[model samples]
Target: MKIKNLIPGLLVLFSPLALAHPGHGGDHGFESGILHPLTGVDHLSVMISVGILAALFGGRSRWQMPLSFIALMIVGGILGVSGLVIPGVELYIALSVVVMGLLLWRSVQISHQWVTVLVMAFAVFHGMAHGAEMPFNSHALAYFSGFVLSTFLLHLSGIAIGSAVLRFSASGRLVKALGAVVAMLGGSFLLS
Candidate 1:
């Protein structure tokens, strides 16, 4: 493969580290939930994969899934801020990357309603992680806006990449490969 074709793969491999936010797990006067996704590798992968799956599926599924995730995430965040305990939040997040990647790889299509339920469930874990990490005294509006916007953009970026891949002849196989990679990474996360 040429350097151009390799760029996306490189980007994917390096994304978690590249997007690492400062003051992560530190006192930033920011809500933990808002910053949670930014600091965690699993969260980053799931968010990006959500966007990619949206683009690959296209139509209403594209917008609907991510929107469901974002909306539900806020509710989760609220729960997190309230100190509500959620078990295995991190593990579920890692699993989300694996699940979404596989779904995209197979080019699987599910009913819109089911998709809504699934995305909402995952978003709660994501939101809770973020909410739990935020500082209680932080500027609430900016903290919330930053995380929500960042998550949306990550999803959008994935959508864009998937769209671009669709234009290629080998895109289907490429997607499956991406799924495998995500699964591997997720498994590693789970074990660690």
Candidate 2:
């Protein structure tokens, strides 16, 4: 695809990375805490893609998968704050992108139970990153809330986008193609 055509999607896809937080210092305020995930491409893409996949394969999987991610991510955050570091976090995150991308590309019908485990694993890596980056004085709860809310919205946006895609011809094929695109992005991220 031409760079121009890719620009809009790429911007939307990577907007989260451009964002940053002032952290919850003495007077940084709530919005600062909330927008943390909006500053990272990896966080943004993974969260949004999770939502998209959930919607594409609607039913219990929708809620189960994302919820699993949120829960595990919180645990990972705690670990990060406690300085209990987990190695290969970046690799896991990159793998998440690749796995999710391939799932979307193939429209894979993963078992609902397995989906939860997969999401949870991915969440740990994601959450740890958040924890590592958090400001020392930031209000922990508020910062977490910010990321959770942002992630939820990204998922919702994915659902909406997936719904739109379903209206087209051979949506399954198109979605799989989209998945391939996502996987390609993940590959690029790994290389970068």
Candidate 3:
């Protein structure tokens, strides 16, 4: 759409990356897990982009998409913790952001079932990444719970923002613009 519409989304997507914290180490707990997604731009962008995608899709997708993501993410996490290697986890994760953003930018209409599956697929990478990073001696259950909770909150935040943009702004250009920004970020990740 219009360049102005993309500006807001770009800002939201990029601002957090600039402020992302370097990965932390040492004692792990619920708190550490919660902070993990917030610390990395990749995690943060993907999580939020999922929420936005859900919101844009509307209907059952609003809840189903996010739920599917969390469920499959847990499974992915299990795979990671079990030492199952999935090649190109980083590449897939980055692709998720790009695809989600493109979908949002284009406002592509896909069925809820397909959307759920799409989200679930991307979530595996996210969950796996988190699982692989678990501290060797940390409480696995607690850490998993922490990241899940944090991820849910981020999705909710994205939904709220997306909903507001769609409802308040005329033409909903803002959301589309944000999607472009998210996609750009993904492209940057792929290149780096």
Candidate 4:
């Protein structure tokens, strides 16, 4: 069958992701934490887009941006675990995907300072989501560490993909298209 024929099936696979976070009754640990981000399309998109943006910016932003995000994310997680509520965390998390996708699509360049600020802004929400949903019986440190590691890996993957894509002569269009699809996903979720 052609690729077009498989689109509907693939879209169905992603339907449950609209909820973003669902509770778990049993104990969860490092493994569960690691899988949390991967299982949710919202988390995956922003994490990867951050990496792509880092790659696009190059130089100091390559490390500085990701570090800033991770640091702020940890703080967000702490806030979440402490029951300090940030109103509209879920809406903002979904919005992150749309914002990031637009940046990627347009290939916009902002100052390193602005990049750090924007990235950290969204990072908090992601961390909060992970924090708020943490299993009741899980080891806090291990679970947090698992998510941290997972976020790092996802960023790394985005960097690699972005770098590789940039090397190609037709990369701009491909990247732009990717951004559109990502934005659409976030948009659909918001509208739904």
The list of candidate 3 runs beyond 4 A from truth reads 1-22
lDDT: worst 10-residue window of model 4: 17-26
Q: Which segments of candidate 2 are over 4 A away from where they belong?
A: 1-29
TM-score for all models, in order of appearance: 0.79, 0.82, 0.85, 0.89
Candidate 1 global lDDT: 0.73
Model 4 TM-score (2 dp):
0.89
For model 1, what is the alpha-carbon lDDT of residue 162?
75
For residues 87-176, what per-residue lDDT tens digits would candidate 4 score against the true structure? 989889889888888878876455767767989999998888888888878888988898899999999988888887788835488788
Better of 2 and 3 by lDDT: 3
Q: Which stretches of candidate 4 lie over 4 Å from their true place?
A: 1-7, 14-19, 23-26
Mind giving the per-residue lDDT tens digits that candidate 1 earns over 24-143? 663553344345566766777788778777776679978988898999988887887778948877677777766766666666556556656777898998888777766656665666
Q: Which pairs of residues have clashing backbones in candidate 4? A: none
Error of 1 at 153 (Å): 0.8
**All candidates in order of TM-score, best leading:** 4, 3, 2, 1
Error of 4 at 141 (Å): 0.9
Q: TM-score for model 2?
A: 0.82
RMSD of each: 5.1, 3.9, 5.0, 2.4
